[model samples]
Target: MSKSNFIKVIVAGFLITSIVGCGTKNFKKTPLDNYIVENSNEKQFSVILEDMDVDGTFFKTYSHKYRVIKHKEDDTPYEQISDWIEVDKKFFAKHEDNLGMVILEKKGQGKISKVASPPGYGYVGDSRYGEWRTHNGSTFWGFYGRYMFMNQMFGMINRPIYRNDYDTYRGGGYYGSRNYYGPKKGGSSRYGTNSQQTRKEKPNFFRRRASKSGWSSSRSRSGSRSRSTGFGK
Candidate 1:
């Protein structure tokens, strides 16, 4: 080969390698178990994954926003707190799809639970928090006077938790295992990273970084088992 042609080929290969390497990163996951164990003293509580952010630098790291929810008693209002936990690329990838979902919950001195679900669903069929109601013959969830705060807190004011949506979520048995967002009928689900309601809760995370990373596009990818789980699937 001519020297000039050989030099051009070598340059092309070098550029391709650089592009690929730029996207590759090695990150050690900060185990979610650690987070759960940190708060095990609470009798009833939930740890929610609210948002995810990737830092822009030569070496990228991640920051995860979490909301820890607790209700001291059946009649009392829930107490909620939020904080940011910095994590690595590997841990980020595992939970990036679960933004605005519950990652851990313990009820009434029960064991720490790692089943994932959209927030406020545990109250759907329970009579303590709410009861079923009808609007022009259409059924929906109606929170009691004291539990009214959940309507907005759970993103149900605009989204409106219809009976069918909750039934489908439960019928699919997605309550404790798979991360569910509305339903998976008609070849699509009504809620997820794209839902306006979800977007409202998760902030403008994907919208701000849509073009650069295609984070939304890659959300369909399955996640690996949680580090906190030891039970067989």
Candidate 2:
């Protein structure tokens, strides 16, 4: 073939290869994708995953718990507590309101704690400004984020909790607790004093069991219950 004709043929082959490559490219979903799919049924709920280093932000992984406060017209102020899940260097969350109107604040202290109230004694208020009462007439500060609320609602679903001797099982699934993805290296757990670890070391067996027990059907039932409960207590 002539040189010019050969050049044209080569160009055509290159174009075809490029097109095929682009068409067959696979897109890998991140952990954020899984989180969204898990909580997709939540109405008016959204997610924002960002790197803590962006713009000198302080929303670092395990360093802060995000408070999402929703303000509605002629309605009671709604608030939710969000704990960021770190995948690599980015933080992931499932928020309950409009990202713009919501007030995003960090809870005091880098860690989360539990405050139990005495029997017959109600209203355990924290020093924080956002005060709310549970159905049991117990007052507590901070809103329970989507994951946190679900973790509590479903009898401590499948999360890990830290204790005196070592880590133990809890009613709630992993959310803002120290036992979600195991310990991390070079960083302290917000919930406990455990050193760095990985998810493989502490697998979320609850999730595996749920899947084996037909999680799809159970999830549907659980979603209905969650909607009815309305995040109270």
Each model's number of backbone clashes?
A: 0, 12
Model 2: per-residue Cα lDDT over 49-91, one tens digit each: 1111111123222212233333345422344554433322212
Residue 47 lDDT (model 2): 25
Off by over 4 Å in 1: 1-31, 73-75, 108-112, 184-188, 200-203, 211-233
Instruction: Provide TM-scores for the models.
Output: 0.68, 0.20
* Count: clashes, candidate 2: 12
Clashing pairs in 1: none
Q: Which regions of candidate 2 deviate over 4 angstroms?
A: 1-26, 48-77, 88-233
- Candidate that would win on TM-score: 1
Q: Residues 134-172, candidate 1, lDDT per residue (tens digit)? A: 999889988999889888776677777788888878789
**What would you estimate as the lDDT of candidate 2?**
0.29
Clashes of 1: 0
